[model samples]
Target: MLAVIRYSVPESQSQDFIKQAHVILDTLAGEPGFQRGRLARSVDEPNLWALVSEWEGAGFYRRALSAARMAMYPLMILMVNEPSAFEDVYVSGQEE
Candidate 1:
């Protein structure tokens, strides 16, 4: 499963936002079933960012979000525009 959180930050607060985002990523990295995660900034819109993470499944992802040690929620709630989860529907060459 893929989890993505999009953030809209002000130009002056980009640095601070990035810092907090890294902390969140670091914390999630240690959780069970956390496959990989990355932070990306929009090329056309500098203030836009997305925290993308891959998990083993939806259950694992949900558990991580509710974990006691997950301290990034507050910061996330402040920054995130819309967060969502998705299941893989297709892959390149998979239909061949």
Candidate 2:
């Protein structure tokens, strides 16, 4: 499963946003079922950022959020309000 949270940040606030994002990523890393996570910005639109994470499953991801909610809340508040969770239906490089 994947969890992708998008954010619209002004260039002036990009540094601070990146810092807080790193903190949240670090906090979530300690939780169970966290495969890996990445913070990315859209190429054409730098203000458009995404916090992407892969998990063992939706349950694991939810549990991670539940466990780290407090620590991540501050940064999470900056995320765009929308559906962020996704199931892995296909992957190009991996064998089925």
Candidate 3:
């Protein structure tokens, strides 16, 4: 499973955004079934950012996100209103 949260942040608050993103990722990392996470800024759009995390399954993703929602309520509000969870049906590196 994957959780991809996107944000539209002012460039003036870039540093602050990164710091907050780290806190979010760190918290998610401690949860069971967490695989990896990354914070990325769009090359085409300077104010666009994404917080991507991989999990073992949808259940894991939901639990971790719920935990994050409770713990980081302030930062969680910054996530753009959109669907964030996705099932990983395919991965390029894996053999068919």
Question: Candidate 1: where are CA atoms >4 Å away?
Answer: 68-70, 77-83, 93-96
Residue-pair clashes per prediction, in order, are 0, 0, 0
TM-score of each: 0.84, 0.91, 0.90
lDDT of 3 by residue, 4-83 (tens): 88988888888988988888899999999999999999999988899999999989988888888755576665678999
Q: How accurate is candidate 1 locally (lDDT)?
A: 0.81
Model 1, range 45-67, lDDT digits (tens) per residue?
88888889999999988888777
Model 2 misplaced stretches (Cα beyond 4 Å)? none
Model 3 CA deviation exceeding 4 Å by range: none
| Winner by TM-score between candidate 3 and candidate 1 | 3
The worst-scoring run of ten residues by lDDT in candidate 2 lies at 70-79
> Which model scores highest in lDDT?
2
Lowest lDDT 10-residue stretch of candidate 3: 70-79
Output the lDDT of residue 38, model 2: 96
TM-score of 1: 0.84
